[model samples]
Target: MRMLTYISVLFLAVLTVGCGGVSLPKEDIFSCEGFEIYPDSIVRGNRIYRAVSPREISNAWTLPDSTTVAPEFISTLPMADALFAKAVISPSFLTPEEIWLSLGFLRPEESMQALRSLAWLPENDNEDFPYSTLSPYWAAAAWEVYCATGSRTWLREAYDALTRMLSRQWKLNRSALSEFYCGIPRGVTEQSTFYPASMDEMSRFQTFSASVNIMRAYSLRIASRMAGELKLYAEREWEMEADKLAGAVNDCLWLPDLQRYGQYLYGDYYPIVSSVTDNEANLLAALTGTATPEMSAAMVGELPLIASGVPSVYPYVVNQTPLRPVVQALYGLSAAKVRNPRAFIHSMASVWNLSLDANYPSLWPSLVMKGLFGIETTPSGLEFRPMVPEVFGGEKQLRGLRYRDAVLDISLNGTGDRIASFMVDSVSTDSHSLPAGMKGHHKVVITLSGNDLNAKPLRIFEPVTVPPTPEVKWPTANDMKIVGHDRLLHYDIYLDGVMTQSISTDNYHVRPGECGVVTVVPTLERGSSGYATPPHVCLPDDEVISIHASSITPRRPPLHFIKDPATATNYIELAARHNTRITCYVNVAVEGDYFITVGYSNGSERCGIRTLGVNGVDVATLLFPPRRLNDWVHVYPSTTSVIHLNEGVNKLWLTYVGGTILFNKLTLLKRS
Candidate 1:
């Protein structure tokens, strides 16, 4: 009976493989599990792209609460990259007509009802479209969509829209020396220097940017291709125009000193070569085939400057603004993958780490499919030329990949393996090519048995060293009492009466066996005004620590406490109309029973109510009785409250409930 059962199972396995029935792996090929942060999803017409939230309005010094404001619209570069990602994972989500329509909406005259908040309107509130520096990208995006879905109607419509926009709005400047149009808008290049995207602030004001010119050249080539596909009469004109621009960029922008294109052109004549190199421009030059072999090699050599896994200016110096931009990183990494896979993999890992820290959107999976897998959708069919990096382990298979109208299950066996034998639909072939214009589910089995995979990993970037800032001294605390100096900084209570941790509020409870030499440390530096040394004290296990509200740090709104003329002491004024809240950081070395005491003064005739919260959780409501006019004496309302605290960092917050109240200090006493 056992022999019969084994024989039956063996036959079933052979039957499944022979019949082109492929099984999917239990694990997803690109899973975000165990990652510190995952990219946020943006959905458009059933297609999703992992996108980073737009820069918070508050980051720009805008006063409106960010929580209430809608996130800014996705920019051109990120949107293009997202489209690419969508095409790779779910090709059906992107249609050439839809992509063209979306790009059209970017025009100011179009009805914004479809785009809503995603439309970019100029600050002047005029109907004039904000001139986009990235106008060429729309043409490139349309070309990609056309390549994925061969729709003549869609291509024609895209061609019309692109020609109208570029001819009327983005008119090329014809140079007297050359027949090619060499001019871009005056401020087109300025858009590249947006903060946290690129660090070319020094060249932000330059009228002519080398990178923008390269992109223009690339966009023209794509437009010419699309025109040829449609048999349009303007095909030759587009091609000639593209050729002229490419020639002019090489003639004017190329710098002998750096052996690469200069950052930008000053006054459209003098090429201003700065110390900083723009990686995005060089990468674009390589992708567009405008860079010479020597120039491409030089660009590859500078990969080390992209230390943060994304392209920032080379030889990154601290305190310099406009850090790494996600768009440059995505494009730069993609360009490097084909020329240098090892460097590409290393940078991918580094960028992944940064994404985790910043919660930035990622294009990793898309790059993996397009660059590593080398999947290109040609007019003929899906082309597969996988370039596996040495860092990749053994056999890998990507299943459930949607290509056009077909669902493909592709498996690659072994690392550093070339296609020894290729089988499509159980047919053996010497050439690893799939039939063009085939629809429906397809099974592809690739067997690779070549040289052993190279196990060594390449380190492409240098270590970044951060400069040290001035140290801040915190208030002192004894086992019996704790005193704070700055209301903007939090304190930690350490063992043995040594201030080990900082607490923001008096809401934390003390645990047993937490007593020792107590020490108080400030979480943030008060800059030059900070203490020369931290304050410390020794106290019994059941001693109490008192913290003044003035010692806690205030994070966002820029205001300082007002000094009392009589006492010569500072106190925070709550009379401002803006919403205000104070946070205190406290560390408890050991958890135990603790009591909290809040000192507040309300001089108004009406009683004031303030909400008390510990570690983001509302714990109690304290009321301040009306005091005599002009009275500023501190009073502890509703006796000290007992609350439990864990053995770690504790945050306490005092939020204004109603009425004006002046906070003085908080006291935390350990219970025996």
Candidate 2:
């Protein structure tokens, strides 16, 4: 009987895996190849790159070349929304004495500390609880990731946190629970009382939108699944409670007239009332079943009208209404409506383009492709579950959907009967046999900016000395004195002794280091006259070194190196006691050897160039063992294999690796 049961289960698994005689081969939905990128696409890419810098894209787009490539626009969701969410809550809860704790803002260890503190709150007799501000949003996001992946560890952590949150919620405001006022938990300790400066005006009822009810719902959904897996009664209770809360929310917040849920409280005097146009409310309404399918469809259909500003004077405006576009694409494509599905897609594309225009970045493209294009993967190979629109125009070609260590590119036929190609890490190739005739969306997620083989190196500072002072040139011990105004004291100034230049001023505005530079010609020759020198070099103790200037007046205005170029090389020279960094606009040509040189000369010694590259890309170069040259250096890309160079302008950046070095010029070029 046991053997028969095992066989039955296995058969069921197979049946579920291959249902309706339709099988989907794995494919990537986020493809950048066919899109008509504008001529200034590079600038948009730069914006995305900078917005999510230092995090390195890791989800939905890892390729075999050891590179993590995230769609610049698509990767911003995780970067910005996540950041905004965290920023909103960090001030209140991530503090000591809070019963319900977090890892303290963005730091995981700090969160652990808060959690541990909450676990042992009995010992800390402090009166005010902190972290109530951000708890719900953080927990909701955490629960979201766990649900999306079904990861056990995340579920476990989330369960523990929920347990603590429930305990605190029950303790602080038991009446709130009964009144259906489950929002941000109140502070039990004094330390956590100060909410964000912006939220000073928010009423207590408005706090649930911070994280409460939504996270509880998501958490309950996951707990239910986990309980089934582990046969845990607590999980069952959570699931029931989640459903109860969902029903309560529907009853309290649903607005049938507006086809959306209200933000925070339901009544008109409740501070944050429902903006009939708010997208989040619509999404919550649909997810919580507050809005009927027909209503949901209406909300989706009205997206084009809202976004195009048909009812209002403005068009293509985005301020605090995320639901207008995301929900339109997410649920619009999924819902069954008389309107062409492609119209929803077009609407989504237009909104996404608007976001780009306004300089917003996120993993939006990936979400659209996954939700609308329906390209997902399962345990039994891969799945291509596309939501084919009647007006889809034709087939769509997509490349670079990636997993932990796999890359899958796919091409879909309009009729959904064709399989174009499959490559994992640009090496393993396979011919896919996709079983045809399917009509359901698959769940395949590709990580963004992940698995980039030619990954750029971290920006590091390298220091190079400009004036290599030898032991012989050093003054004897008896002659050494700490001079207050020594002529050789300027760290980043470039001037040869033979130049016969002397510069000084009163305590007025642009007096030397204050901002502007003062240049003057003295009566001395380039080699200098007698031993004392003639250019009026200031001694260390001299308050001011008076020099015969053609004229003496403050500079027209102070200049910032970042705003205007002071050097001829276009390289902004920065003074540093340790290392210096310079940034320019330049593209790497090949994937091989690259060098960054800093040149300097006091009309004598030359500062040699330093080479730095990873996989032949000039991500960064550091010159070690600082030598003084005070001359121009060429930072070039040298390689065994040729890398493509784009036509037009590029910025080149240089930094001192270690020990200060003066940079006179900076350049980006292909090695000869």
Candidate 3:
């Protein structure tokens, strides 16, 4: 049965070959696990269900109660009321069962019981897409309940609900399949939900997903331990289907050189290709036993770049860049080197800094307190791993680790693995024979010794002055600027209020009045050869900000590619070397709309628009290419095509075909 399941998985994976290729980080045994999920996703998912409570609002716009905390905050937060409420209320989609099923929760069942208030969703079925976005909870809540009680009734109900949901969304109406199938409007309505249908994506094509992947991955992992607890093991077909879905997902999303999976896939198209691979794909692939060697290798090698100690969609990956502290540790661990434990531990400590920068200081604290500092719930009591990273074998100081109500101060005697005795609030523990695992947020002190596993004597404390806190700012949204011949946007440096260096046109002196108005109309390259311009900074690294535009209004000007304008009147080239979002506006009144020709670079195989938002303002239109990048490179309009854009700003962002996009220019003209 296992062999059959594996074979089915491999076959389904072949389907994703059309999705594209990206280089994945080297495999970290710890990182591998199909349907691996982010802690934020669960927390965020729970928050969504709580936000839509009927008692809270009529439409989806009611303000949350300031005094009365929502279900999520109540349970997750450590306050008495919050804890009490979370223990009983059981929000619509949250349940102890599902919480227990989470990979992060050590005592899953206990955690579930702690947040019991969020047990089941309200029983409202069909109203007005009431559950349009909140549908994933059905599976989540059901899984939780089954895990808690091990009741056959719960299992059946959960299975039935999931199957129905799959049928409703993927089969019957086929809603939200891929951007190639249906292009929905963006904004509060679509952006509010995390569970984007394949339509809202470019990497997920003809694949089954949602909470199913997570549930199945956990089920397969725990089946051996649970024994006769759940019947999922008996259903071989379910396992087969799950494997198939995982295979298809990989085939459709994984990219080789880029080393990550697309956010989702479309019909032979992967659009909106962000530089970072989706973390969900990484985790999911690991759990499913379907991760390619290449994928694993890329992640393992690039561990230094991963900030959260896990891959995510945000913080992008750079080639050959120095690894972040935590990532470096994971990388070392992935390589299984005990000799370099200091580097790993020291890197782990530096993770605290990244936490501050990512605007989530509380998050890494949770990990450091629990995972690294060695706080966890194992079958054998609490375990603590206090190995700190040391780049070089030497004496070091540890400070400000809060355990319970006490603050801990410890000193390391040496660089290597020699156990030097140290005092924790006056009590001492040997550095060498530290306990196996530690619980989250516990104070301890010990002296470090020897470079190798050999123990050393206790040494004196060495404390460095605390560095001044640097001001951290979010990256600016206005990174790109478009300028015409008359209006040039350029970059200029102002030293002591006097404009000095400038980035363009001429070396002419600028009037002091026109100083700050200077912008860097960056000279964009057609190929990926030029050094990537550092994100435009408003200040030094202490308070740096990005210069990219977040959202552009009034729509971007239409770009027209010219192919010997004197000869080839209509034909122009469409190419780009990176993923770009281009929105074109057209004012046509004919029943047949204008033809926008999309072209790709040389090795590019697919390209398509990930989103199309139209207010139905464009009068008279036909043939919207539901699928742009596929077996072919260009899309032609059809008389019966539904590709109609509103009269005003028809926003569309084209991406590379199955590969990367290096769009040169757009070919715009009447359909004729």
- Largest TM-score belongs to which candidate? 1
Task: Give the Cα lDDT of each candidate.
Answer: 0.46, 0.33, 0.32
Rank the models by TM-score, top first: 1, 2, 3
Residue 164 error, candidate 2, Å: 3.4
Query: For this target, which candidate reaches the highest lDDT against the unseen true structure?
Result: 1
Q: Where in model 1 is the C-alpha error above 4 Å?
A: 1-134, 169-206, 256-259, 292-294, 304-306, 315-318, 321-337, 357-362, 430-436, 447-672
lDDT of 2 by residue, 1-672 (tens): 334433433443354356442211122111121121121111122122112222222221112344333311222123322222222222334433121111221233444545445444452211212123234334434433343334466557766665655554432221221324333433212212212112222123323341245444654665565555556787767777777777766665555564445444321111122222324344444543445677665554443243221111011122222223333333333332323353344444343444432322222333344433454332123344344433332434444433323433444434221223333333323433222222233222221111112212211112111121111111431122222333443211212222222333111122243221111221122211111111111223232111111121211211232234343333323334322433444444343222233333221132222223323354432322222233233322111111233444343443443232333433232322
State TM-scores per candidate.
Answer: 0.47, 0.37, 0.34
Instruction: Evaluate candidate 1 by giving its C-alpha RMSD to the native, one decimal.
Output: 23.8
Task: Give the range where candidate 3 is weakest over 10 consecutive residues by summed lDDT.
Answer: 36-45
Please give the distance, in angstroms, between residue 319's alpha carbon in candidate 3 and its true position after superposition. 21
Across 472-530, the per-residue lDDT of candidate 3 in tens digits comes to: 22233322332231223343333222335645443334343432222221221221111
